[model samples]
Target: MKWFFKIVVLSILLQSFQCTDTDDNSGAIISAQLETKKQEIQNYINSFSCSESVGCGFIAFGSKPCGGPRSYLLFSNSVDLTKLQAMVKTYNDMDELYNVQTNAVSDCMFVAPPTEVKCMNGICTIIK
Candidate 1:
């Protein structure tokens, strides 16, 4: 009876450790996916070029755990605006979901939007 009790307790402990490891692995996977999505959005933005400040624009990107966008991305009008917006929306949605799943915490500070976007030295950039 004593040996049986010990084996049962050990089994329960091992199962608990395995469950914890699985949770950690899943969280890491989600984080990696978020980074990949962010890179895709950035690569798409960088593929376009700008010649004039008037042609530069900014879009809100990423989701803060507390609420609102984490920051803005500057882009040129030369890119496909519709496609870019859709990609950004998808990224934002993923980020929001990740935050909720991970119980992510932040300072909750409001990130101010850029006052202006400009084409500076052939690159679209925020002027704030």
Candidate 2:
């Protein structure tokens, strides 16, 4: 009876450890998904090109743990603005959720928005 009780307790302890491991794995999975989403946004932005005539614009991207965007993205106005905005929203939402879930910390420094955006050479550039 003593041996059986010890064995049961050990099994419970092992199960608890396994549960924590699963939680850690979930956090890693979320991080990976966030990175993938970020890359997707970048790829979409890259698909469009800007020239002096094409025009360029900037949009805030990603949510910080403390609030506000992590950074801004520059893109050509020739792209599908509606689709791009939707994708950014999705990515931001996921980023916010990931921050909350992982208890992510940030410097909480204010990121200034661009003073101007223009097409420099063949690419859209943000002039700080």
Candidate 3:
């Protein structure tokens, strides 16, 4: 009887530990997703065109305006509206839960949470 009780307790403890491990992994996965999103925003910004006055512009570093959060989506002066629409759709599909804001500067793209769109102006430096 003693041995059996010990075995059962051990099994329960093991199960609890396993559950904690699973939760840890889920957190890590979420972090990775956010990192990937940041990288995508960086790539888009690096190619933004500052020459065009009408298109998107980058905001300087250390200055992020609020709106949820914001992401810049810059493009050339001759951005294809249809293509931009498609890209927006694709991004929305990636994470259905969080709202995505896309700002299009001249040849650049800044992507962030919807609250931070205003910061996506003339600062075209790549965020490291």
Candidate 4:
């Protein structure tokens, strides 16, 4: 999943570098299109999971926490354009449900939901 996205981005970046030798609007247009595609891919991914630790906070007492609620996703099988995906995430400290569509797929994809944050219960340390 992640590899596919990396390949796409890497290819775009490589193309950008390769374009410098030539003088034309082609490079700019290509980069812009590729970047837009990347953004679309990212938006589609966010519907599944958090790209990073988000809505971060912990359940603790007096600055010492025991546990915390983290963003999680239960993505369905591969996307079907004919259907919509039920996506959930924490918004304003509440669970927000969305029926968003899967727009695109990427080779270098990073599925969501990171582990416990670097800090646990107000204590900063390695999560591992």
- Better-scoring candidate (TM-score), 2 or 3: 2
Using lDDT as the yardstick, the better of models 3 and 4 is 3
After best superposition, candidate 3 residue 59: deviation in angstroms? 15
Regions more than 4 Å wrong, model 4: 1-29, 50-128
Per-residue CA lDDT of candidate 3, range 1-128, in tens? 99999999999999887844334333222435645765664565455444435444322221122322234454443344464555444444443333232321232245442222222355433343
Q: Which ten residues in a row have the lowest lDDT in candidate 1?
A: 20-29
The regions of model 2 sitting more than 4 angstroms off are 1-29
Across residues 1-128, which tens digit of lDDT does each residue of candidate 2 receive? 99999999999999887844334444343878888988998998898889898899989999999999999999999999999999999989989988887899999999988999999987998886
Top of the candidates by lDDT: 2
Per-residue lDDT of model 4, residues 1-128, tens digit only: 99999999999999887845455533232334434543554365435431234323222111001123232322222333223222111121121111111122234333334455443343323243
Q: Per-residue lDDT tens digits of candidate 1, residues 20-110?
A: 4334444342878889989998999888889874488888899999999998888888889999999999889989988888899998999
Which lDDT values do the candidates have, in the order given? 0.86, 0.89, 0.42, 0.33
Q: How accurate is candidate 4 locally (lDDT)?
A: 0.33
Off by over 4 Å in 1: 1-29
RMSD of each: 5.0, 4.5, 10.9, 21.7
Residue 5 C-alpha lDDT in model 3: 100
- CA error at residue 78 for candidate 4, angstroms: 7.8
* Order of quality (lDDT): 2, 1, 3, 4
TM-score versus the correct structure, for each prediction: 0.75, 0.77, 0.32, 0.20
Candidate 2, clashing residue pairs? none
